[model samples]
Target: MSTQTSLALWAPRLLSVLRIVAALIFMAHGTQKLLGFPPGSGGGPAAMSLPWIAGVIEIVTGVLLTIGLFTRPAAFIASGTMAAAYWMAHAPRDFFPVNNGGDAAILYCFVFLYLVAAGPGPWSVDAKRR
Candidate 1:
């Protein structure tokens, strides 16, 4: 294949990697909340009460993203979780996403949105299944 074609083919693969990485990150946060596995105090089910629901979404959606199963729904749920995180956890501060800002949530929302629109591409299990 030509250089352009090769780059084009690999582009989706790179995006898949990004999706997996982002999902894994979200999964870790969810795991921390769900199971106080690690030594330190995790985000426990009591940390933020209402918004804690996002923890469930994060865990399920992260798994979906990892396997490229139900990509759209997973990304949608992930986006919602991030949005909730922004409003409930970070919006009280500035928008810079620093110490207590909504930056991380904003970024997470965008990442999930991208995956939703892109549909997991060639490197996903969804693609393989099809």
Candidate 2:
């Protein structure tokens, strides 16, 4: 096959891989916030607060995104969560992500936004169901 054809064929698979990896990483953040696993975030069965709420959203959306179920909506929600996180937690600390430690939040926001526009690709449950 031509190089262009090869890239075209592989693109969807690459998107699926990206979705899986990003969801797993995002889920880890939730685990840290809610379960205290991986030993960070000072988490422990969190109370009903901003962090707790964000953690819940993260976990739920992460799972949905990981399995490619309701991917567009999940990604859209995740993107919104990240936007809120950046504004609420990081923006107040500093103007730029690098200064405020909000790089991950910003990155996740854009990536999830991309996923929202792109859908879950061929390997997703969304694709299978269709």
Candidate 3:
């Protein structure tokens, strides 16, 4: 097959890889906040507080996105959460993302936004259901 055609054929699988990897990382962040999986960091957020609520959102959306169930909506919510996180929590620290330590947040925001547009791709529950 032509190189272009070969690349195109693998694109969907690559997308699935991206979705799975990103979602897993995102979920890890939530767990760190809510479950303190790695320990030694800090306690979970206070109940009903903003960080607590955000942790909830992150866990839920991360699972949905990871499984590619309700992928679009999940990604949309994830993207929004990251956007808010960057602006409210990170941006104030500095104008540049690196200085603010918001680089990861910004990356997550755009990556999830891309997933919303791209759908779950192949090997996803959404694809299976369809």
Write one digit per residue (lDDT tens) for candidate 3, span 23-105.
99998888889999757476888999888888898899999988999999999999999999999999999999989999999
**Top TM-score prediction, candidate number:** 3
**Per-residue lDDT of candidate 1, residues 1-130 (tens digit):** 9999999889988988988889988877777777754444734777566646777778889899987888888998889889878887787776567777677688999999988898886778899888
TM-score of 3: 0.96
Clashes of 3: 0
Write the number of the candidate with greater lDDT, choosing between 2 and 3.
3
* Local distance difference test, each candidate: 0.82, 0.92, 0.93
Better of 1 and 3 by lDDT: 3
Q: Top model by lDDT, which number?
A: 3
Better of 2 and 3 by TM-score: 3
Per-residue alpha-carbon lDDT of model 2 for 1-130, expressed as tens digits? 9999999999999999999999999988888888887787444654898888888988999999999999999999999999999999999998988999999999999999999999998888999999
TM-score list, all predictions: 0.84, 0.94, 0.96
Ranked candidates, highest lDDT first: 3, 2, 1
Residue 22 of model 1 has an lDDT of 90
For every model shown, the clashing-pair count is 1, 0, 0
**Candidate 2: worst 10 consecutive residues by lDDT?**
37-46
Any idea what lDDT model 2 has? 0.92
Task: Show pairs that collide, candidate 1.
Answer: 97-103
